[model samples]
Target: MSRAQEHPAPDPAELGLTSDCGSCFGLCCVALPFAASSDFAVDKEAGRPCRNLQDDFRCGIHADLRQRGFSGCTVFDCFGAGQKVSQVTFGGQDWRRAPGTAREMFEAFPVMRQLHELLWYLAEALALPDARPVHAGLRGALDATERLTRGTAQELAALDMPAHRGEVNALLLRTSELVRAEVPGKKKDRRGADLFGARLKGAALRGANLRGACLIAADLQGADLRSADLIGADLRDADLRGADLTGSIFLTQSQLNAAKGDAATRLPAALSRPAHW
Candidate 1:
């Protein structure tokens, strides 16, 4: 697995991991950098707003981002970082209006994003009945991360979130082990497999250790993925129309955004299917 895939994006609702662009200052459009790849049409430097960003902090072509060569935008989520930076850190100040604070705002956005993502995972870990043994530690981490997320701009920009994540990640690993113990099979060690575009319809993958597997564009229709270790697995464009993903670990909305699913797709409680699905 690539180093970038080691961390992924977040119970969105109760955990505040869901994106709320309406209340945001278009931080994602400005704070993130993207090159002209298959995912993006144009090269945009960090702290520079995308040309598609509207004056109202909305995307001018929100409905047709992919059609406009901005597929990356569709799959991106700020994990509530944009709104937090806009409302809490800057007190509703926007970069365009207050150019003085733009640099700090841009710098702190990604840091806040990481903290928020950790909070989302910690919240999920605490919710796992099988992971109750670590609930106290998870709750402590959640509270600490929450406090960090509410820090001042300088504090956030200087935050060492990776240190905090390492601590939280250890707890999550314990949580995963406890939950996977109930999968009722000898766990498969398929970690880092390059299963790209492989046909695996109706496969018995329950409790499989598929961590960091490159299942990109693979046909997984009607597959039984219950209790699979999907942490860092790339599900981009993978067909999961009727696949059962209940109890899958570390699956993210970004991964779901890049895939196709339907009513027959059973998901864990923390995840919801994309509307386009």
Candidate 2:
């Protein structure tokens, strides 16, 4: 699990952004597809239950997943979509019990997942102090997004998530600008830089724009990255110990999942410190 904490201690307001595996019906294990690669021991098709998935919707080898070559499962976080689908959308119905409804249920899982992910981002954006300028809009968007989550399965499957995301992204970008402006000095616009394996340890990157940057295996230990814009930044294997990410924009759990960090890595409240640190 990248040595990240086996379990995440999430913030109270960010509850919907965290996983509640116990309340879920193992939707991810059943609805997601995995290829036979370094992350998985065998290939599995979408909607097919994993061999290790227990009858009770738990991983049979949860504690031994890594040793059993199921590391890919460890990195995935459905952001509370699983339970919302299983308990709320499907009314606690398991796919096994209602085989006829399996296809729609499986398809709606991804759709609701995307919607819930947007809620996660929107909730975080609304809480940012610098985002006060657009709180009303963010709140409206949050309400709308939350409403979508409660829609019928067909409505979610037909949802134009890209359109909704576009609207929310515009507000998030504004929030980023406002937060970065708090720091004096011209923000470095390094969006989409190919910094693969770059050694940037302890670098002064506060308020830097690293949107979509390729930072694979980069050494960024102890770097000052407060208010940095990290939208879509590829942070796989990047060393982030002791780095400060306060007010950093658009940093997702998935990005953090792919990176290496320690206890000293200061993260924004929306994200948690990985246990591996």
Candidate 3:
């Protein structure tokens, strides 16, 4: 059966205007592994079911994961990857029915998740009034990322995600530099500056405007971003292992959805970590 028939049509609100997690097979919880931590407090391997996941694949502690000591569950967002992989990509062939497909499905989940995340950002960039100058480029990139998501299972399975991510990184970097350039004293203003690969461990950026900053590969292990404006920051490969982004304004879902960070990565209450991360 096709995904549409098996999973049913998605509601806009559930998908977060991009991808929905409810229409998924709990792919993130099943396909990805997690270790014991203050966030999770348990160890699970890839393709294994999370202890909190019930027989129907719903989180057993859905209503009280935080109070139940599974604080990690409170901060996870799949960016719609779970539904895309379970329904559209695999055509609703679940792991239980086709156990042999588990490995491939697990591998494909993260790959497609990253592509969908890029789509999210590209879509957001197009909607930005200040990013008018880069609209054409953003649209082009968005189209390319969207097309990539439509690749066949074989093609997606063999994709070199790191390399593809690098290509997209370049375009995102250009967009950031172009948009932030319009601000006065662009060089002097650290707000929204490209800090890719810069060593900023333990640095202070309280109340600073970091909108559209490119933080790819930057060392932000303990930097403070509280109350900072992180509207369009590029955090791909950025080491925000312990960086705090509480109260940051204009920090969109697409930004966190695309970036790579761990449980130690502190986020605004509005956003959460990707379940598969």
TM-score of each: 0.89, 0.89, 0.66
Clashing pairs in 2: 3-276, 4-275, 4-276, 5-275, 262-277
Steric clash pairs (candidate 1): none
List candidate 1 stretches off by more than 4 Å: 1-15
Q: Name the top lDDT candidate.
A: 1
lDDT of each: 0.84, 0.83, 0.68
Reference-based lDDT, residue 110, model 3? 83
Q: How many clashes show up per model?
A: 0, 5, 2
Better of 1 and 2 by TM-score: 1
In the range 53-131, model 3's lDDT, one tens digit per residue, is 8666688888887567676565556667778778878888887778888888888988888787666556545544555
What's model 2's overall lDDT? 0.83
Query: Ten consecutive residues with minimal summed lDDT in candidate 2?
Result: 2-11
Identify the candidate with maximal TM-score. Answer: 1
Residue 218 shift from truth in candidate 1, angstroms: 2.2
Taking all chains together, the TM-score of candidate 1 against the true structure is: 0.89
Better of 2 and 3 by TM-score: 2
